[model samples]
Target: MSDTMTVKEAARLWNLTERRVVGLCREGKITGAKKQGRSWQIPATAKKPLDQRIKSGAYKKQAERLPLPIGISDYRLASSQYYYIDKTMMIKDFIDERPQVSLFTRPRRFGKTLNMDMLRTFFERSEEDTSIYFKDKKIWSCGERYREYQGKYPVIFITFKDIKFDSWEMSFEAIRNIFAKEAIRHSELRNSDKCDEIDKKAYERLLSGQANEIELSNALLDLSRMLHKHYDIAPIIIIDEYDIPIQQGYMKHYYDKIILFMRNLFSGGLKDNRHVSYGFLTGILRVAKESIFSGLNNLTIHSVLDNKYSSYFGFTCDEVKEMAEYYGVANKYDELCAWYDGYRFGKTEIFNPWSVINYFHNECEPRAFWQSTGSNDIISEIIAQADNEIYDRLTSLVNGKSFTTYIDTGVIYPQIKSNPSTIYSFLLVAGYLKVLKTTPSFNGDYMCEVALPNKEIAFVYHKEILQQLNQIISPSIAVAIQEAIFSGNHAKLKDLIQGLLMQSVSYYDSVGENFYHGFMLGLCALLSGFFVSSNRESGNGRYDIQLKPKNKKLPGILIELKAEKHGTEESLKKLSQKALQQIIDGCYDVEMFAEGVEMIYRYGVAFSGKKVEVMADSVSSKETIRLSKSDYRSF
Candidate 1:
């Protein structure tokens, strides 16, 4: 074998791309690889490195050193074989709270399924002594008062997290299969003499996959009754991601059917069912507005806005810090916090467990790990139907701003279209935004100041939420307008914006400065490397818009906008100059100057009907030019 080989040779020999080979060399994954000018030299004798792409179930085995459970939701496996955080204390909380039917509403991948399964493990009666999974954990330390419940009750566990389908028929079939699987798990009741003939027949129908809609609706109730009769104890019901199918139905135009089915399922299983010991459900939102739990008055909801069980769903600050120390990346705690630690569940600050574990698994590099964990269809739908006001607020959120809004934590799917204000509620429960401050509102609602949760969500919200502005203003127009603004081309900017207004705005919409402000704000939000702000205190007074470059080398920008009910192009031209003078007179460049911006661009834009005018000037700390009030006296 040759002592040395070029990256190209190694790539061909190892069946990898040359760029990948170069990366491996640079990362020091390729043994004996050395840099030679811009290229890499590798040892020919060195074996090809293992591919970093993980196949599904690739990490199922327990290694000599336990790996972080990246996707493991099974409580038994995750708690026993992985570096599990002891969440058995959640059991203690549930017992203490003792709600008859507790529903936990949290965002996807925030450990909802795992926590529910943990409940199943701690409470379900199993022949194999499942108490072993809880004895060494926090619940065991709480004394016999709490520990007495471990493995004591029959449990009916099912997850609808993956029950996504395009039509009602397929969705129902998927649901039936789920219940059949669960029924088979409890097949002992099929032959038990304690079970009545009718109950056993209903169980057999479920197990045989022959249950009709009405029969399936009654399945949970019948099974719970049979379990009670067979074991002489009522069963605990655990439903995880109970709203995933409903969300899918709303997205796919089968909302009514799914809601009917879910309503009936819960009604039979949970509402006044003496056969059920206790019921627990977890999902992103409480769709009680859908009437799914209409008469189930005993249901207790702990949403993202509630203080109960707050720390159980996601990693707390201390948990994350402890995890970092255990993984020997204690120094990366601040980075981890910045990227993943801004989620506020109730009053508790929470870090995304999925992203945190993946961060450590990926050797502590930070990225938007949680963004791709689930579908962003809700975000897409919200952005698609957003009004100008919604667009303005969304723009502010992406620009590191927060605003007070009413949050209906029990946000329904239909409200996404009918009630635009509910967007904040969806974003909050779906884990896109974090509450900065929250106050209780009427009837379980919340008035909260919310913003993009963390750097990860900031990146995600910008990419997922703000990018939807393209649907309103096309990408080409956005790019052209941005180019004109940055290049100091007043004529081009005016022409582009005027064309957009004429093409997109209604005659009614073109009459207000607020409309134009939101339009321009939405466009500016798409800009990269700029800290965009609107109606913010700058210089001496509020500036309509300010673009402070994240990199000081780029020029800073301040824009003041004006609108008139009716005016000629000549009058609009004069109004634009008046607006430009407002920037100078108000000293709007002071904040940028304080931030060490060497160059500034000030733009004045005016709109009347579809006609537009723009005036722009450059300011530099290196020089000063004074403008007289006579510049706008002609107006």
Candidate 2:
């Protein structure tokens, strides 16, 4: 640690590879003096600790009172400092058991990136500034083994989520820029012969706004190798969102070319490079290791089904409780857990951190908070391509399902044919669904069946579908239906129904009577605090529509609609008889119902071709039946 210490000594003292020390020097984050023989002398003053630099007053204040780490960006280090979940023990067990390139797949927004970041911060060499992060953290409490492991190894981290391109050239350039940015941050390369060349060339190319993906990847690898040479140690590589490019490439049909280029480019630096220590990668889908890391034999796969390290990537139930208490929302913990905490990654029962943080920040009233993250354009694409079977499953999900199976990621919206299974699978991985059962077979394989994890997710799935459907159908359809129902406008309602039948024939075919039932239900579903029941099984039979207004004083409307392809009168009579029977079967006394509650109005509506007829009746007190016509219209 002396001013005249060699790069090797600095590496030893800092628990870093010679390459990383060199990288620090190249980025100007460290200082070194060169002798006549061309070797650099590392100065103790040049190495500012990570903890000391990053733990400024502003950061400390922010850390002390942060609500929850939602949409957190700097997961590599910051997450550990403020709200680190104890997944290290699990990770350690996994690493101890295997030595291969590991892939941990989960749904999007399930904290995959955060886990990768934690790994990087845990294993990577740190400057003095980083000590502030580990102080008083749980890891330090794990005793000497944990303390001894701090500030160890050189870490190379990358996230492919930001990589976007219309062509291979654009993707290459984007990657190159990322490398250049990282290199400029390390001090060891500032005075290196290779650093000077790469820096000069990179800046010029950047200034010119020119550089392709291949060239950029090459330059980054070359720079990485130079750092490795200088440090005389291998680099630990951690990649996050690794499937992004492939997903995009698959969509754009640039898969073949981009895969070839990316394969060679990443393999050159990560697989072929002699200075690599270990690697970990994460994504929503598990692309075959052979396709990406061809020669890396020591790869370990930790999928969602893997028991080891399942808790490593998500918020556990205890962690959720701690977060609620920390944020002064402990009272709402039960409600919060009911909505968001059913997901089980392994033995750990977890909640969706993104939604949880959003709930706290917004004062804990549950809503579709997760949707604020993105437009879910991929889902839109899937729905547009989905087949009849997929349509049926979606209906089942909306109605409620006890179990569903995970669909293969590849089959999710296959390019050639629309696969319903793919849509279901995507929802499963996207945190919209969770595994409910794992049944083992005699062949050593397991079947993991999933379902909507909680009520919030169930509502979200339905709402998103409605939103998407709104785009495809008339935007005014929902509004028109709502107005018609609230105002009891039989004419407008009939017209809307006829229009829907004309336009949505295929959808009706896909869902049967449930289509009409759900459509009517949707009108009330969007309104908060309203109770709606469709086909509610009773002693005698099911009730078609039972709408209970939020306020008890407001009259609940009971109505039934029937397809009167024969004629309106017959259909109306049948509807009236059914509605009256519902009241008798449920023992609903009209007179003794809540005071100030409006009298129940029973309606029997029937549809025949382009015409709809409405028949209204009121049950008399002395067992007399009184029938009347409110209004009738044809479209």
TM per candidate comes to 0.68, 0.65
Model 2: number of clashes? Answer: 43
Model 1 per-residue lDDT tens digits across residues 413-474: 89878888888888888888889998888776778988877767766675577656665567
Q: Give the whole-model CA lDDT for all candidates, comma-separated.
A: 0.82, 0.59
For all the candidates, what are their Cα RMSDs to the real structure? Answer: 17.3, 20.8
lDDT of 2 by residue, 1-635 (tens): 34478788877676444645665666666745454366667666566435221110111223457445667756544445345455556445544564545777887777777667667766777665554555555566667766665566677777888876777656666766666566555556556564457565644453343555555556436545655655566667777887777767666667776677667766776665676667778887655532766775566666666677777666787787887777655555655665677787766687877787776665554555665565465677677765656665665655445554544533322442434456655676667777787776555444567766765665566556644654335658767766666666756766786676676534343333333444555555665444554443333333556665667655456666554343465564555455444455453434223323454444555544444455444343344443323232222
**Model 2, which residues run further than 4 Å from truth?**
1-66, 76-91, 94-100, 165-169, 193-213, 217-223, 403-406, 409-420, 440-446, 466-635
Worst 10 residues of 1 by lDDT: 53-62
| Residue 394 error, candidate 2, Å | 1.8
Q: What is the lDDT of residue 34 in candidate 2?
A: 52
Candidate 2 accuracy as lDDT: 0.59
lDDT of 2 at 177: 66
